[model samples]
Target: MPLAIVHQSYGRFGGAERVALAHFEQLRRMNIDATLFWSGLVTPGWQTRLKGYDIRTIPSTLPTPRNLATMIRFLRELSRYDSIIIHHHVDPLLALYLARNLGERTIWYSGSMFELAWEKWITGEDYRSISQTVKQTGQEYYGKTLSSLVLSNNVFDQTVRLARTVDIHAVRRYSKIVANSKFLSRFLKRIYKLNDTPPVVYPGPDPMLEQLSSKDFTGEGDYMLAVSPLIPLKNVDGMIQAASKVPSARLVVVGEGQDRVSLEERAGMLQVPLFLKGNCHSEEELAMLYSQCMFHIHLSLYEPFGLTPVEAGLFKKASIVTDHGGPPEIIVDGETGFIVNPRDYGMIAKRMKELLSSPELRHEMGQKARKRVLEKFTLERSAKQLLAEVES
Candidate 1:
């Protein structure tokens, strides 16, 4: 049977989209027919960034559920595909649409619940208490999907406790739940409260980064390389804050987003020499930055499965993963690199000093980091595990 990997959009080539694309490519290599589905327009840059897939885009908007007929028709078109792996941000409205027609063919891949925080950050209110219309929409979604699932699961307990009608539909409608990390697996069981524990299918690392060498370095290897989308939740501003405390340290922020203006202003006010490279054009350029950097640094508040640190590890660069979601699975604290408290610039500054001051320490950690990534995380391994989950 054909497989469909769905994400909201391909407007940008971020970590989540990379993972989704990686899954499509990996599964195809395993001799399964796979296609990538998106609901929004794919940016010109995305067309350049991604290759090798049958991509289909449909016009559909979330929250309004105004495209009910569109969804119904789309689901009908996808009748040939056996299942859909939803890369939802803990929002299961898509699964509800599928269950309304496709029934037990929906598998919601719960990556992280950061949407809850994003909602609070963007709008000063919880998602459940947004409006009467949204609440009614949530009720309609759950009412339709709950009966479709046959697993004797406690699909209602957590949603009832959380007091959100949306949660009830999102969690109960899925025929299967697959987590992208161990941290997310735990969050699924405890926070989302799924009766069946989701399987862990770690994201694959890009093969090109594994071949990086010092010869690739065309720039001075003096600055610390930090890759983030320069967003608030990414807490890259925290990295800027921490870099400011270390007078000698220079940070090269690689990636772009809406928060560039504020991040640049903050970097200037703090009088820190910050080099911002917005949306790297090619893998060669990204590899050059990785090969030349003294070390890698990531300090996101709620990182689901950060591929930046893993990419750094592939380039044999020592990395400090700041925060508690998926980095713990990748980095062995004080060995590969340190994991400091989220947004704690003081601790981040201290860790930065310890590694930056000592050349030997950085080299040793980078070597160990690469070794860990080889043994534990890779595209081949991730593909095999994920195929097994979806096929079963």
Candidate 2:
């Protein structure tokens, strides 16, 4: 029986797509029969990379009330596969439909509940209300009456309802559920009221990252490297603030988003030397940055799995990450790296000072970080665990 790996899209590439592609490659290298099914148009840079893979495209738009035939055909096509691993994020409605129809053969790999998470962040509303409804009312009552119960005109509330609908009705019914991190698994358990936590399959860096030979720097690099979209949620400003306190350490940010202008302006006001390298998709360029950096910093608000830290680890670099998210699980405090409160720039700076002052400590921590990554976060390890779950 052939295995099928389903991902939402490659149009807006991020950690999830990277993990999916890595898993597909690893499985095929192991000589397993696997085909990848995805939706949305492939972005330009990824076209060359995905040249010779058995990838099939699903229709971009979800089936509506008038498009019942399209939904039937798609489901029938899906049923042909022995088992399906669906990556959720871009298309919850499709995930919902697939779980409802093919629950027995499906394993839902949840990366994030961003629909409700972003809504709560935007509206400053309590997510627990929706969780309560889903938990107490169960699927039947909430599925039919959620529209009336939630504020119809409020966009955030509407999103919460739809997200909860999928959580209660669709996600829990799958044969198995895998979360990207323990942080996310706890959140899923709370919302779905599951008897046990969903298994966590930590994502690894691209295989190329692991294969690159480690460069031995004579001394610590002058700049601190950060690789994330320059958005408010990512807290690029926090890095700027932290860098301002440390005169010797410059800050280099590698990804771009809406907050770029503001971050640049803020860095200018603070008189901090900040270099912004926009959207670097090339592994070689990223590897150089990672190899020559003093250390990595990621302080995203409630980051899901934090693949950048893992990527940094592969390059033999320690990191300082937010305590609120999954990085705490990856980095061992006082050893591999430090986890600090995202909002506390003072604490971040303090940690940075500690690393900057001691080259011996930094190199030792980096070596340990690389060892940890090899033991825990590797494509081979993650793929084998995922395959074991599917086969069981």
Cα lDDT tens digits for candidate 2, 1-392: 58988887523466777788888888888888898887654545466767887888764333346456776787898899889988755355666778788989998777776444343753354544323222232222234354344534556466666676765677777888888899989977876788989999888788877876365535446888999876566788888988888877689999766677888999999999899999776667778889889899999766778899999988878899998868999999989999999989899999999998888888989999999999999989988888888888
TM-score of each: 0.82, 0.87
What lDDT score belongs to each candidate, Candidate 1 first? 0.71, 0.77
Instruction: Report per-prediction Cα RMSD to one decimal.
Output: 7.3, 6.1
Give the per-residue Cα lDDT of candidate 2 at 368: 93
Candidate 1 regions with alpha-carbon error over 4 angstroms: 40-52, 61-67, 88-92, 114-164, 211-215
Model 1's alpha-carbon lDDT is 0.71
Backbone clash total, candidate 1: 0
Off by over 4 Å in 2: 41-46, 64-68, 88-90, 117-154, 213-220
Question: Best by TM-score, which number?
Answer: 2
User: Could you say which candidate leads in lDDT?
Assistant: 2
